[model samples]
Target: MYVARDCYEQGVKDYNSSTNPWLSSPLNFTVSSTQNKFVVVGCDTYAYLSGYQQNESYTTGCASRCESTRFMVNGSCTGVGCCEVDIPKGLKNVTLESRSFQNHTIVENFNPCGYAFISKQDTFNFSIDSLRTLRDQQMMPMVLDWAIGNETCNDVENKSNYICGGNSSCQNSEDGSGYRCKCKDGYDGNPYLSHGCQDIDECQDPSNCNCPGQECINEPGKFTCFCIKGYHLDQSAGVCVPNQSSLQVKLLVGLGTSFGTLFLITISLVLFNAIKKRSETKLKKLFFKKNGGLLLQQQISSNENNVQNITLFNSKELEKATDYFSENRIVGKGGQEADRSLSIYFLHSMEENHLLDILDDRVKKEGDKEEVIIVANLAKRCLHLNGRKRPTMREVAIELQGIRKTSDGQQNYEELQFSRSEEIEHSDVSFTSTGSFSIIASTSSSTVLPLLPFKTI
Candidate 1:
């Protein structure tokens, strides 16, 4: 029999025919005696085979038997002091029993039983109280079973009803009787159950794996990488970044082009409007100066100095009075039409030959109309000749009012005559070598002389 060194320190006793019981000694020894020996101490005991024995011997010890208070069940040494052991190689069977010292009465208060058996080391720890009754034990009995095959996982998988799923491989158990399943690479989880192995997405976690500048697409048990837009990945850095300054320059150029187009449009529009407004103002000024505005002002100033009642009409007022210079309001007789048309021409010529000639002709043709003749002749003489010689139109107008106050039965003739006196004057003279005259007149001094030689009617 073999025992642990620690078990021998607990006072196991040894006995043999040649050993001396009188000498006190430690009970640790590999018994090599020629005869079988028994080791008994308190309630614990053991039997060892003699030297060189191929099989061990077993026998009963003293008759101090202890009551059986434990039993083994289901290969577990769990009930009381009784236990099971792994039998050694080539071993058949062994018998076990209980023993007690003092007939189990001296130490019955603590330990009422003892047991003996052989077991694998560390399988059982004996109670100290059991040593009190160790002497009564005879032999312990145990059984062992053995098996004979060393099959691998492949051999077991060849059998029907194998549990390994698809995408899985089997591995032999270390004991060599059974097998276990594992999923293929890129998969995880239990392979024995249906749909147990799952595909691993490498793109989900940023660490351990990387797509970097590319798109990481997970497929069945694998992944794919593709570069992003606007940047090519540098294999060294394994990431995508912006393109070079050339791209930035191109963007700036496009932006500047767009702004330049808009700015040109704005400037063109401003210039167009400015030019159009300037042209309009220039045309208006041209019309104002060309339409005798300066001449009109000069005439008005001269008339004012002479105390004449001359009113200067604005162009709009004159346009309204003449109905926009309509043809119907134009006054003349045949060739004299244009001379009487415009007021500026009429003013300059009214004090010349035209008014006097008209007055003389009227006086001569109407003798019974003496008062009318007198008023017309006076008005004619007042406004006659050049600027220095002519009387102010104010003076002429005052004399006419005096005649109107003094006239009686001649009022009708005077009224008709007064209206004609203020009519616009026009000359029909044509300059010639002989001084051609459309309307000729004789001066006061010349009226006393005879008619001229080449004079016509």
Candidate 2:
């Protein structure tokens, strides 16, 4: 029971339990002292717990006082900051009220409110912060003793109104009123209802298995543990052990274990190789798609006139020819600067009979210088800014073949034939295949040069 008072306003409140109905049922309801305790929390607080037992009145109280918060220890209810007292046995109803010496005016800034309650002992732990605020919660849980009626267990054993069901037993309450029902061993659940008690299967719970590596046999309300086949209980080791048998059986077991290990290792190696091959195939496909291989193939197929001798060098071949793109192998500045410089250098090198320096030295120098100059000039013309000023690569290829025929016994390199002159309608051009250009001719209305590094002049 709680005593109501205006804690937010200044006043002297009277304490009384006359309005509480709990006092009228003292014989049937007893306050549980073991389950609950009286508690009061505040800096300048005092609380009282008064009750009646067997027509006699009993009064007890506790005073909690603290000058500062330094004397408080959290989770403890001593007389310094918070206080707790155990209720007396056989006390049925109790009333709780808070009192202060000076209306908490001395420590009003830190603790203006006080709280008093009879709550479950296990659930109430004092905290120093509660002195400052209570968060609008004014009540706590309390336990009350309950029984069927005023009767001993033996007196109600054979009565027609006895509520204890099958598989249940009755025990006289400690308060001397009635009896409480409880299920028997190996059973659980509410005992007051018909068929409420149910058998417990210990073997069904994995954690209940006291015997490891053994067969657990379940029975009605009980279970048994036994060793598995081919094993016997080793009492000293407290575990199952294999039966001591002939040496031939042991030899076969060892052989089987060795075979299993080898089989696992073989499977692991096969899977490793399979994963590696799959990754490599996936990487090759990615590289091909990224380099526009399909687009190149489509262009080559469209050139029905002269697609012969067209070659697409793989990465390994091009890397070798360019000396792996080492700094020394680069002829000029990279990008557009290099593109322009390479075209000029190619023409100059050919006119000066130094063409072998740009091309592979492996090429035969037996070719005529006049034929080389004619082909070089045509490539240089393709570098024109205006396409109309430049002869298309097709026209250049036509002239290049005529010059090659004049130098008839020279070795010829395989070359790529362009689809149309429109493909070369830009100022920039790069023909890199095996790091050297090749010559090929096609009879088309458009002009384009094959195998030579060229730009529209």
Off by over 4 Å in 1: 1-150, 156-159, 174-177, 208-211, 233-457
**lDDT of candidate 2 over 1-457, digit per residue (tens):** 4422214234333333112112334456877867888887787788777877655887888888888899789888878778888888767656666778777667766776667777787887778787755525545678887777889889999899899988888988775467889998778899998999988888888866466558777765577778887778899987877777634578789999999999999999999999999999899889878978777787798976566668988779989977786655553333456675787787577557676568654433654455455555665576655668888667777777755553442333222233322344463455543223233222211233244443222
CA lDDT for candidate 2? 0.68
lDDT of 1 by residue, 1-457 (tens): 2221112212332222012111111122212122222222222222222121124543333222223333313233333333332332322233333333344444344443333344434433445444444434333222222222335576767777677776678775432244567898878887987788888888887763354446777888777676666567677876665567647977999999999999999999999999999998899788878987677678777765554566767779989987897865643311245544443343344435243344457565763343454554554354344545655566666665655544432444456444444442234433431221211221223222221122111
lDDT measured at residue 117 in model 2 versus the true structure, 0 to 100: 76
Candidate 2 regions with alpha-carbon error over 4 angstroms: 1-27, 52-59, 101-105, 121-125, 132-137, 234-239, 246-252, 256-457
- TM-score list, all predictions: 0.24, 0.49
Looking at candidate 1, the ten consecutive residues that score lowest on lDDT are 17-26
lDDT of 1: 0.46
RMSD of each: 27.5, 19.2
Q: How many pairs of residues in model 1 come into backbone collision?
A: 16
